[model samples]
Target: MFVEWMMGLAPGWVTAIPGLSRAAQLKALGNGVVSQQAAGAVRLLLERAHRT
Candidate 1:
């Protein structure tokens, strides 16, 4: 369905486009971003950014 269409189009790349508004799309983008950041292994960045 929608997931198949998206996965087919992007092939595992989740990007936050200008016109995409679906929760699943947003969640995909969010997860992609978080995964990328987490892959960097910079845990201190989260703490520093949120420790205001």
Candidate 2:
């Protein structure tokens, strides 16, 4: 569900979207997926964050 929402967002508007970074917003949208073992969606997001 969480992954679906994030994937639904426009790539160009991801960072522009409000309350979406630095306050663990992704972690929030991610629910427990952020902490689960082998959470691929969350891992990809963290990786993207690192690139920026």
Candidate 3:
């Protein structure tokens, strides 16, 4: 439950994966972040800061 929240995954999303344990799912999610999405968020923040 905590892992799903931390990873921003929808409910039951983790259980859909086959053959992976909960621990492994949590580990992978912890280490995973979409680089493009992160970059976009940073850019948006910077732009907003500049405007303020």
Leading candidate by TM-score: 3
- For residue 18, model 3's alpha carbon misses the true position, in angstroms, by 1.2
lDDT of 1 by residue, 22-47 (tens): 77765765454444445566677767
Which stretches in model 1 have alpha-carbon errors above 4 Å? 1-21, 34-52
Please give the CA lDDT of all the candidate structures: 0.53, 0.53, 0.76
The candidate that achieves the highest lDDT relative to the unseen native structure: 3
Clashing pairs in 2: none
Give the TM-score ranking, best first.
3, 2, 1
Native-vs-model 2 lDDT? 0.53
Candidate 3 lDDT over 1-52, as tens digits, reads 6766665668667656889898888777777785567989999999999998
lDDT of 1 at 35: 44
Task: TM-score each candidate.
Answer: 0.25, 0.28, 0.50
Model 3 lDDT-worst window of ten: 6-15
Worst 10 residues of 1 by lDDT: 4-13
State the displacement of the C-alpha of residue 2, model 2, in Å, after optimal TM-score superposition: 24
Candidate 3 local lDDT, residue 50: 100
* Candidate 3 lDDT score at position 2: 70
The TM-score that candidate 2 achieves is 0.28
Which ranges in model 3 have alpha carbons more than 4 Å from their true place? 34-40, 45-52
lDDT-based ranking: 3, 2, 1
